[model samples]
Target: MAGVGVKDLLSADDIDESDLFDVLSKAAAIADGKLPARTRPRMIGLFFEQESTRTRIGFDVAASRLRHHIVDISASPGSRLGKAQGEDLEDHIRTISEYCDLIVARTEHVATVEEIARLTHLPVVNGGNGIGEHPTQALVDLFTIERRLGDVRGLSVALSCDPTARHALSFMKLLALRPPRRFTLCLAPETKLSNVAAAAIDDLRRCGTIIDRVDNVEATLDHDVLSIQTQRASSIISGRIGEMDTAQKIEDEKFTLTAEKVLRNRSKTMIMNPLPRHSETDKSCDSLPNAAYFDQVRLSVPIRMAVLSRMLAGRRWAGRSPSRSQPGWPETSSPISSSLSRSVN
Candidate 1:
C-alpha cells in the first residue's frame, strides 16, 4: 500500500479523499494477507506525552505484525520526550533520529508533532495531538463506515461530539474529503460549535456536502451513520477537548442515545464512537445490532497496519535525511490530489 501525499500524517487535511480511499483499500489487502513483504525491517518509535488505551496498543501490535521492532516511550516520566529529563524536544528527536525509521507521537500540543517534523526528516505520524487531530483514528473510522454502509458516496452522516475534540475534528476533516451527501451535527441544546469546527464543516460544503445542525440526537435518526462522543471533566484536565480547557459536558439526555431510542427510530442508522464512552451512550445500546463502535476496534489493527506499512515506504533514518518535501509515501502519481485536495475557501 502506498501513502497519500504530504510529508507527515500530522493532520487529516494532509491527505485528501483519494489518499483515504487508498489507505482503506490497503487495509483490505493487508487483512487478506496479500501485503508485500519489505526488503528489511526498521525500528518504529511510539512517543506519547499523553496517556492512551486503544491507539497505543493498536499501533504496537500493528508494528509487530509487520515484523518491525517498536521502541515505546510514554509520559511515565516524560523523559523519553525530554520533558522530565530536562531536555528539549530537538535534543530528544536528534537522539531518536538515529534509532528510528519513523516516529508516532501523541502530545498535549499539536505543535509538538509539528516540531518533531521540523527537527528531523524522518516520517512522523500523529497519534493524537491536543484538539487538533488524530488522523489515524479518523482513517480507521472511515474504514468502519464503509464496512457497515457499503460506501461513503451520497450517504448522509450525523456527528454528535465535542466539535473541538481531536478525534472529532479529524473525523470531520476526513468526512469533508469524501463529501457526504448531507452532514449533520446533532448537538445538545446550548452546546456550541467552535470556530475551527465550523471551518471544517464549511470545507465539506465546498465539496457539495449539504450541512445541518440540530439540537436533538433523534434528528440524526435518518442519517446512514451517527458518530457520537462528548467532552467530560477528564477531557478538560487532559487538554484533549479544546483550547479553553474548562470543565464541560453535554449532559442533556436529548443528546444521548439508548437501545430503546434506536429501536424506536428503526431507521437503519449505524451507531459509532471512538470509545471509553460516557452517559451519552448507555450500556444498553451495546446490545443493538447497530453498534459498530466495538467492531470499529476490531478493524483497528489492519487500518493501522496499512498506515504503518505505507508510511515506512522509502523511509530510513541512517542515511542522510532527504528534503521533507520528498515524502516517504510517494505522492499520488495522478491528478486525484490536485482535483480533490482543495482547501476550504
Candidate 2:
C-alpha cells in the first residue's frame, strides 16, 4: 500500500503494464456506477499553471464525487509562483505536502514536477508538465480505447501532431510499454520527433512494435487508432517562438479529419484528441461512430477518481466497499422515507 501511491505519473514508463491495467479496470467500474463510492476526508491540492478545461474540471468533479474536499492553487501571474516568492519549487512542494494529502501539479517545466516528486512525501500527480508527460490523460486514452476496441496491444495506432508536445511524447512512451503492433507518427517536415520521442520509438522497436513516420495523411490512414493532439495551440497563442501564432491552424485540405476520412478506414478506426482541437478536426466528424475524442473527455472523470482513491491506499476511512451493488445512500433530497416514496410509485 505504501508504494501504491503514485507520486508522479510522468511517463508511461512510470507504470508497468499490470499496474496500468488494474487502475484502468477500476476506473471503468467506477465510471459505470458498478462500484460503491468512497467517502474519504482526504483533501487533494490542485495546482495548474496552464489553461485547462478538461483536466481541471475532471479532477474537481471526480474528487467531489468521492467526497474529498479540494484545495486549489494556481500558478498564474498573481499567484506566488510568478512573484518568485519565499521558497523554491522543491521547498514549496515539501511545505505544501505537509498540509494536503496529495498534490496534483500542472507546470510549464517537467523538471519542476520531477523535482517536486523527489522532494515531497505526499503523492504527486502530473496534471500536465510542459511538453513532458501527461500520464493520466494517457490513461484516459487507454481506457477509451479499451471500451471501444476491446484491446490495445495488438492494434495499430497513429500519433499525429507536433512531436515536441510533451503530452504526445509521454503517450508514445506509454504505448511502448503496452507495445502497439504498428505505431505510426504523422508529422510535418519541420516537426521531426524530439529526442524523447525518438527514444520511445527505439523502445517500441525493441519490443517488436513496428514504428514509422510519414509526412502524408494517407500514410497515417491505415492505422486502427488515431490520437490527435493540439497542445501547440497554447504554445502558439503565447507567442513563445518569435511572433508566430497562426501555426496552430492546419490547412483544411491537408490535415483535416472529416466524415470522408472516417469512412476511408478499412476497419473502423477510433479517433482520439486531447481536445481544445484546432482546425485538424472538422465539426462534421463529431457524430461519426469512430469519433471518440469527446468520449476521451468523458473518461477523464473516473480515471481521476481512481487516481484519488489510489492516493488513499493505506488510510482506512469509513468508505463502503466497492463490492456491494446497492450501497444505499441518500442524496441532498428529503428523508429516506420520502425518497423511497417517489420510487415506490
Candidate 3:
C-alpha cells in the first residue's frame, strides 16, 4: 500500500479508490498491532474553531497513539488566538505551522482551512469545514463501512438527514469518487443534495450509483448501511461562542429511529451515525448487534492513525523514504480533483 500521495486532505475528493483501500488496510493493520510504530517525533497542531466531541477526541487520541506531540488550540477568549481578541486567522495559522509538522483544523468556514493549507507548507487536514465538508469523518465512515461489510463497492447505502449536513455531503462525495459497480443511494424524501454538490452527485450517477428518494425511513432502512445525521436540526446561533438555538421538538414518529425500525432489518443492515445525536436514533436501538455507531466511533482512532501516519510518513523527522512528488491538485480530468483549486488560486 502506498502513502496517501498528497500533501493536504481538504475534501473526500482528495482520495481515490486505491488510496482509500490502502488507508483502510493500514487502519486495520494498525488496530491489530501489526504495523510498526512511527519512529518520528513530530508535533501536530489540533486547532478547532467550532465545538466537537468525536472529531476532536479522535484526532487527539490518534496522534498521541502514533507518538506525536499535540498542541491543542481552541478559539476561546482565554486563548491568545481567540477571535474575540481580533487575532488574524491567517497569522495564527502561519505562526502555528512554523512549529508543527502537520495541522488539523475545524473551522466554521471552508475558506479558513483552504487559506491555512495555501499559506502553510505543512500538511493541512480538514477536521470539519463548516457546512462545506468533513473529509476525515468521511474517511473514518468509509473505513468502518468497508470493515464491517467486507467491501464498499456495490454496497447499498442510505443517507437520512438534512442535506446540509457536512458529513453527509462529504460522504456522498467520497462515494462519488470511487463508486461501486452497482450502488443504491437511498435519500430521505426531505433530503436532497445541495446545488453546490450537484457536480459530485452527477459524477456518482455516471459512475453507477443509483439514486432513490425514499419517502419513508422503513424503506431506506432495508439497505446494507443506514447512516443517519440529523444534527442540523439544532441551528447554531454562534459557533465561536458555542451558542446553539434549541431545535424545535418534533413529534413526527416517522423521522425517529426506534428499536422497532432497527429490528426490522437488524439481521443485515448496519446502523451508523456521526453523532452528537438528537432524536434521529433511539437509545433502545444501541444494544442491537447491527447498531454500529459505537464501532464507528471506536474505529476512528485507527483510521485517523493511518491517515496521519501516511500523510507524515515521509517527513524529514520520520527518517523514512523521501516524500513522493505529486501535484497539490489532481489532474483536471480526475474525479478526485482538489476542491481547493479555485479557492487557492
Candidate of highest TM-score: 1
Give per-residue CA lDDT, model 3, range 1-345, as digits (tens).
234345788777677766776787899998788764657778998888887899888988988888888897556566667555557777777787788998898977656778778888898888987766787788888888888886677688877675556677678778865575443333333343445355555677787776555544676666788888553431341243243334534424665777887676554678898887767788888888878899889999998898888788752212111211222211112221222112100
The lDDT of model 2 is: 0.68
Number of clashing pairs per prediction, in order: 0, 1, 0
Q: What C-alpha lDDT do the candidate models reach, one value each?
A: 0.73, 0.68, 0.69
**Scored by Cα lDDT, where does model 3 land?**
0.69
Q: Give the higher-TM-score candidate: 2 or 3.
A: 3
Candidate 1, 50: how far from true, in Å?
A: 1.0
Model 3 earns a TM-score of: 0.82
Ranking by TM-score: 1, 3, 2
- Expressed as tens digits, the lDDT of each residue in 1-345 for candidate 1 is 223245578877677555676688999887678865864788998888777788888998888888888997554543654545466778878888898998999887656777888888788889987655788989888889887787786699988876667788778878876778998776544455554566677778788987777767887888899998764523652655575523335457777888888889786889999876767788888888888999888788899888888778842222111222333211112221222232221
> Higher-TM-score candidate among 1 and 3?
1
